[model samples]
Target: MSTIVVDHLSKIYPVAVKEAGFKGTLTHFFKRTYRQVKAVQDVSFQIESGEVVGFLGANGAGKTTALKMLTGLIHPTSGRVEVAGHIPFQRRSTFLSKVTLVMGQKQQLIWDLPALDSFKINGAVYGISDRALNHRVGELSEMLSLQGKLTQPVRKLSLGERMKAELLAALLHEPNVLFLDEPTLGLDVNAQVAVREFLREYNQRYGATVLLTSHYMADITALCKRVLMIHQGQLIYDGSLDRLVDRFSPCREVKVEFARPYSAHELSVYGDLQDVEKQSARFLVQQEGLTGAIAKILADLQVVDLTVSDPPIEEVIGQLFQAGTVAG
Candidate 1:
């Protein structure tokens, strides 16, 4: 069943516009100008229980705005959103207790106080008994590898440690759905891996539905098999990651080394020459032409070695963004 449902959900903001300089500012002060910005428009998707879906977009693409609406922090400008079987914008206690929103750049932890104190506060807000609070905190702390660090002041901990602590605090209430924005942002490689591993294990252990957004593709690549891509405040892609690649990327990369040196222009007939060196050249060949291109190259040129491979995931996604339209 779908635990999170968004039906034509959209958010629009009326932003004030102003001109530069003295005369323009005086005119603007007398006659104010405003523009209606569609932060999210006609966005709709459904998330099944226990499904971890990646919400992906460049900055200002409305990923965060959609998340805020889903978590009940902000109401949508139009359409409907249901999370955990309750209307999100209503902010009822039942709805609030069933979902948690965690933003990596924002901190819920008290800077000067120990994370334990903050955990207790969260428990209080959720009406969790002391016994349950201790048990839940212990479980989350163990999962995040923060058994001994939870007592330390948040400010005293390392960046990675503080992030782990923040995660533990968020999960202390045992919410069924989590909306995480940039959950692994700014962490070192090791820290990023740690968080990824922990999230995977936590999801498996608890069957929690997670909707995550991150600039680090590693976070999405490792954690989400399905992804939702928003572009220009609209949901452009909602499907498996593999399918997204196949839908948008029609070309594969081919690299070859000739026994003799060849210039890029000389090899242009074979494929779209991407890089050329003294003895090696790379080409982007359409999937349907990959076989014919390789055959023609081998038959006509003195080939030393050759290999064909899929383009990088990042490159494929970049092409999608540049195209600015979803595959029909």
Candidate 2:
């Protein structure tokens, strides 16, 4: 079943326009001129229950605006949005209870208080009984490896620990739908892996639906098999992650180590050389011509080692955005 539905959704903001210098300032003060800016334009997609989907876009690409609308934090300028069978912008209590939004840059826990105290307050707000709250806390803490960190003041805990506590507080009521933005934003490598593991386990345990947005490709690559790509406030591509990669990057990365140093110009005949360092070089060869290219390289050059693999997903997506080739 589809847990979230967005149809022809759009958000337009009326930004004030002003001229240059003192005259423009005086005109703006007296009678402000306004221009319409389309933050999100006619985006439409449906998310099935129990699926973890990646939401991809660059900065100022209307990703946050769309998330705000889906969470009922802000109303959409036009179109329909439903989450967990409830209209999101209506801000109904049952809908609110069924969904949770976690933004890494924002926090709900009080910095001066122990994390446990904040969790208690959240439990009260959600009307969870004390005994039930404690049980839930214990279970989640164990899963997060946050056994004794909750008792410490939030400010005193390490960044990773504090983030885990924030997640604990958000999941206290056992929300059925999660909208996470940059959940692993500023943690070390180990912390990122931990959070990803916890999320996978949580989805398996509860069958919860998740829609995650992150600039970090590792998060998406690790957790999401499907993705929805938005560009310039419009939904462009919605499909399997592997397909997106293959569609945008129709080539294989070939890394070759030569027995002797070779100039970049000397190797240009093999493929599109990306980099050359010492005796090692990287090239992007079309998948259709990979075998032939490899054979020619091996026959023409004194090669020590060679390997072929798909290009990094971040680079593929980055090139798409840079070239503005994504069509709505």
Candidate 3:
């Protein structure tokens, strides 16, 4: 069964408008005019329990708005949404306890106090018993490599450590579902990898469902096999990461290291040359022509090395967002 479901969900806002003139402004003050803007439009998808999925979009593409609706932070203007068998906006205790939302740029840990102190407060909010809270905190701290850091003031910890500690506080109750928005936002490479590993292991250990969004393709490619892409207030794509590339990416990249020097112009007959250095060239080949292009290259060119790969995930996704619709 799907642990998260969104059907025909939409959120709209009305903003007052005025023409660019003093007379227009005066008239608008007397009688206001408003325009309706769709922040999210008929967006829908489902996630089975224990699945890790990436939510992707450009800025103002409605990804965050959709997540907000799912977590009960904001009500939708229309449509139905449910998480863990409960209406999200209802904000029931059982539903709240079963789900967690973490925003990478935001902080919930009390800055002036040790993270341990905040955990106690979180425990109280969730009605966790003293003994259970202590045990849970200890276990989580060790898992996050935060055993000693918990006693230090949150402001004293590094950005990465603070993020890990924040995760500790958020997961104290062992929520069954996690909604993560750019969880590695400002983290360094190693720190980002650590968080990714932790999330993967946590999901595996407890079978928790996770919906993660990140600007870093590494995060998406590493943590999620499936992805959902939203653009201009609508979901444009949803499928396995590889399927996304296979569908929307109409071209494949072919790289050839020539045995002798070659210019891009010289390689144009073989394929649409995209780059050329002293001894190498990269071509963008139409998928349908990829095999024939490779055959031509092998037969004609003195190639020292050759390889084929799909376009970069970031590049493909950027093109999709720019096009404002999914295309094959």
Order the candidate numbers by lDDT, best to worst.
2, 3, 1
lDDT (Cα) of model 2: 0.93
| CA RMSD (A), model 1 | 2.9
- The count of residue-pair clashes in candidate 1 stands at 0
TM-score list, all predictions: 0.88, 0.89, 0.85
lDDT of 3 by residue, 1-328 (tens): 9999999999998889999999998989999999988999998899999999999999988989899999999999999999999999999999999999999989999999999999999999999999999999988777788878999999999999999998999999999999999999999999999999999999999999999999999999999999999888988888999989878889888989988997767788987787898999888889999899999999998989999998788988887899976732
Q: What's model 2's TM-score?
A: 0.89
Sliding window of 10 residues with minimal summed lDDT for model 3: 319-328
The global Cα lDDT (0 to 1) of model 1 is 0.91
Candidate number of the best TM-score: 2
RMSD vs true structure, all candidates: 2.9, 2.9, 3.7
1 against 2, candidate with superior TM-score: 2
Cα lDDT of model 3 overall? 0.92
In model 1, the runs with Cα more than 4 Å from the true position are 18-32, 257-282, 291-304
Residue-level error in angstroms, candidate 1, position 129: 1.8
TM-score of 3: 0.85
